[model samples]
Target: MRFEIQFSGHENIRSNHQKTIEITKESHLTPQGDCIVGVNASASCADLPRELKDKLKNSDSKITFSISVENYEFIIKGNGHQDLILTHEEDIVIRKSDFICPRTLAVKCDKASDLLPREMVELLRNPNTKGVFSITID
Candidate 1:
């Protein structure tokens, strides 16, 4: 079976410095579906809930990740740093819909505020919609 891999956060998607990786595709044939791929801390830090870990752990391996995929955008706000918008050109960014709290900076997935872990819910809310784009990693 094949799977789609996506990472979203800073910008340099293809780089090794990514913070979070999400696998948007799921296998109905498998026990879990529609999950991200990576370690527990990574997923949790990425804002994926503990409840969803099983599915994410079982995801397919052929990842098609993007560093800040075109469909989504995000902002970074943390202590001692100016709030900024992360882009695809930076190695730290992941794919669309993923989150990353840089060591010195916190992040807000402009499009995915509602789905954030409850503790992070207060940091950011609601992403203003931008132009639409489409990508199918499967």
Candidate 2:
């Protein structure tokens, strides 16, 4: 499977509707189990002093990570690190007895996507795909 990371546009409230964004390769990730890969995108949010808090409140400059498995394509939101878009592709070994077509599959990430400011549940349900994508909160 191949994975690619891309950044897309969104509202930067702090910039007063300005489309200011920066893309860089400084992502880092720690892996778990035999399937999961975790990524850390930014170094600090500490510089957001009170004076700039409101302006940067809801701005998210997210990079898109896409994975192609078999004939299915799955996408997750994150940022890039070193030009490598991070992702975890697992080989889910299914036994004949438990091989029913599952409608959803729960996935756990090192960090948490539960409180992340976007909705992507529907994307995991593409007909071409075989499983559901879930963000387990830690």
Which one wins on TM-score? 2
lDDT of 1 by residue, 42-95 (tens): 122234333322232332312222222333333322111133222212122233
Residue 4 alpha-carbon offset, candidate 2, angstroms: 4.2
Q: What is the lDDT of residue 132 in candidate 1?
A: 15
> In lDDT terms, which candidate is top?
1
lDDT per residue, candidate 2, 1-138, as tens digits?
Answer: 122232212221111111111112223212212122111212112322333223222223233333333344444443212222112131211111211122111111112222222222232223232222221111
In model 2, which residue pairs have backbone atoms overlapping below 3 Å?
14-55, 25-82, 27-81
RMSD of 1: 16.8
Q: Kindly provide the TM-score of model 2 when superposed on the true structure, using C-alpha atoms.
A: 0.20
lDDT, each prediction: 0.24, 0.23
Report, for all candidates in order, the number of backbone clashes.
14, 3
